[model samples]
Target: MELEAAAALGKYLGAGIACLALAGAGIGVGNVAASFLNGALRNPAAAKEQTATLFIGLAFAEALGIFGLVVAMLLLFAV
Candidate 1:
């Protein structure tokens, strides 16, 4: 029973770590988008062509967040 309790505690801690990663990702993605928009607005003509690239950057940022969520799920289910 003690061992089982320990395992459960470990799982929760692991999940918490994953959640922290997600929080960091949220902040990071927000920074990325905010900066991109600020820059785009300041110089719309040049930035027009780069819109696709900007979206790719945004996707990559959000993907990192999803990865963190995946890790959390794995910790709770796979481990």
Candidate 2:
């Protein structure tokens, strides 16, 4: 029984740790946006060309957050 409890605790802790990736993703998205804005302000004409790249960066960052959430859920519920 004690071993089972310990395993449960570990699972919960791991899930919590996995959720930190979401925070990293948020930071990444912010950096991407800030960098794009900086570039845009410096060169307005080129901003239109780089818009697609900005969206791609955002999508990748958000995808990482989603992946982290899935890992956390799987750790918590699926073992």
Q: Give the top-scoring candidate (lDDT).
A: 2
* TM-score of each prediction: 0.80, 0.80
Report model 2's TM-score to 2 decimal places.
0.80
Q: Candidate 2 residues 1-79, lDDT tens each?
A: 6999999999999999999999999999999999999999999999999999999999999899999999999999997
Among these predicted structures, which one has the highest TM-score?
A: 1
Model 1 C-alpha lDDT versus the unseen true structure = 0.87
How do the residues 1-79 of candidate 1 rate in per-residue lDDT, one tens digit apiece?
6998999999989888888777878897899889888988999888888888778888888899999899889889998
Q: Which lDDT value does model 2 have at 12?
A: 96
Per-prediction backbone clash count: 0, 0
